[model samples]
Target: MGKKGILLVNLGTPDSPEVSDVRRYLDEFLMDERVIDINAFQRTLLVKGIIVPFRSPKTSKLYKEIWDENGSPLLYFSKIQAAMVQEKLGDEYQVELAMRYQNPSIASGLDRLKAGLVESIQVIPLFPQYASASTGSVIQKVMELVGKWQTVPPISFINSFHDNELMIDTFAENAQKYQPESYDQILFSFHGLPERQLKKCDHTGQHCLKKDDCCSTLTDVNKFCYSAQCHDTARLIAKKLNIPAEKYSVCFQSRLGKEPWVQPYTSDVLKALAEKGKKRLLVFCPAFVADCLETLYEVSVEYHEEFRALGGEEVQLVASLNDDPKFIDALVAMVKN
Candidate 1:
């Protein structure tokens, strides 16, 4: 008889918010085929020759904005999360924290667990939704590393917890703190993926965007679709908060060099709302479990500025589930069962 091993993985951060470190981080992150979904040579040219060279300094500055005296918010909170889960789980399990793309790599996390010689291992990729780029990449990387082991322990992975009740409640509870009714509209904005990625996830060839309201509800045809899961997550949170369907919009953000990404883009949605004379806005970024660059800098600063310039009064972000006791409790439940 033996204890279970738990490994938690999140999308990574740069070693530091310096230009060189940011460049290295971006190169590693964007070069993933799952991420950019382009031919290797073209990805290299786009990432190395263009993005890394041009965007590194700009991105470093964004990281700097979110970075604090304690360092990267994502990593900082991730550390607290792992420690808390470990403490609550007691000596029955050993918990390890990892990042999909950077320091405290998945390899190290798995190795540490294997050293613990537990009877089984459970891997929880921190992304709430399942996407080829994020959760899928982590699964593939974990398998690729552990597949080499001579004696592999029985292992399981949590693919997605988008509709996890406790998790959704946590997000809704966070939004309630800001008085959701005070805002003119609520936006549930998720990180964007290229339309091609959505198509690839569509098991039925004709299901994706081929019919009206394709992503309006989740079904077998699009159950694994990232956009659908994102929509489902938003719907659950909104329903929990008693928000009417018309009062909120499900949108996507952080698109880059896009041919097209799952739309309506958050930026475009804000413009539409502004044109309609909707001033105050409340935004929930449920995609990210911890408050990082995307939630803290992009949503809070960049989007707010853009919206205000468009004549919107305010764009307030609902804080993420960062080491919140309730969030950690939800995580502990997922780990246990």
Candidate 2:
């Protein structure tokens, strides 16, 4: 009988929250063509000369705020999710965990699968939504590595599972657990990508929505469009909770560089709400299945403080969908398909 296996991959974290470790992680992360999407020489200068040198110290400080005794929340939570999925899937399909960058690299994970003599491999990139930078990068990396092998197992990829029922249910469950006293506003913040990237989807500007009705409407392309899907997630969750559409907003966060990224920027939205005298806020980051730098430090701490500074009375960040049993069931179902 042919061996079947599953490999889970996530955007990784630093080995430690220290400045040095964070710098190393950033170097690997930002250097990626998908992440930076620039020429090699230019990417190097930006990553090493600029980002690693400057951003690392600041990011290291931020990581310290969220880092636990175990380590980076992203890495720790990912491990938990992987183990839970493994347990649920049983022993028949060996499961291995990997990160796109840093330790437990994709190369290493594939090596383990090869050593196990698995006949078929299933790759699950942990990003719930598809983006050229996230899910696309993983597929690119897998193909590059497997292409080098003289003999390779048949591979299948679970691309975007954003609207999976179990996933949506898990998110709803977490939001319910928080039980906000009565939020005047709910914000769904997703990581930002450059507008140039979004335009790349349809350069003619005919197929692209540019954050208009086309994106808001249910369509085949919008089904996989990260920005549209984020809005859809907010709508679904709001429908489940019976929240009014006027009470919620969908925004983007973690924007890098000066390039225009998909917006209603999260920071700008926070400031606007505060200015409008909307004090109570509940923010949810459904883009990230696990709490990472973006959700943990960037949204929970940084954005929370921003809201308060803008005279907001309260800002609560809903937790991520990490190792929640329903979410694990979603993963199993996703792979089973």
Clashes of each: 0, 0
Error of 2 at 56 (Å): 1.1
Q: Across residues 167-249, which tens digit of lDDT does each residue of candidate 1 receive?
A: 99999999988999989999999999999999999777889989658988999888888999999999999999999999999
> Model 1, which residues run further than 4 Å from truth?
none
| Best of the candidates, lDDT | 1
CA lDDT, every model vs. true structure: 0.93, 0.85
Which portions of model 2 show Cα errors greater than 4 Å?
209-211
Top TM-score hit? 1
Every model: Cα RMSD to truth? 0.9, 1.6
- In the predicted model 1, the residue pairs found to clash are none
TM-score of decoy 1: 0.98
**Lowest-sum lDDT 10-residue window in model 1:** 203-212
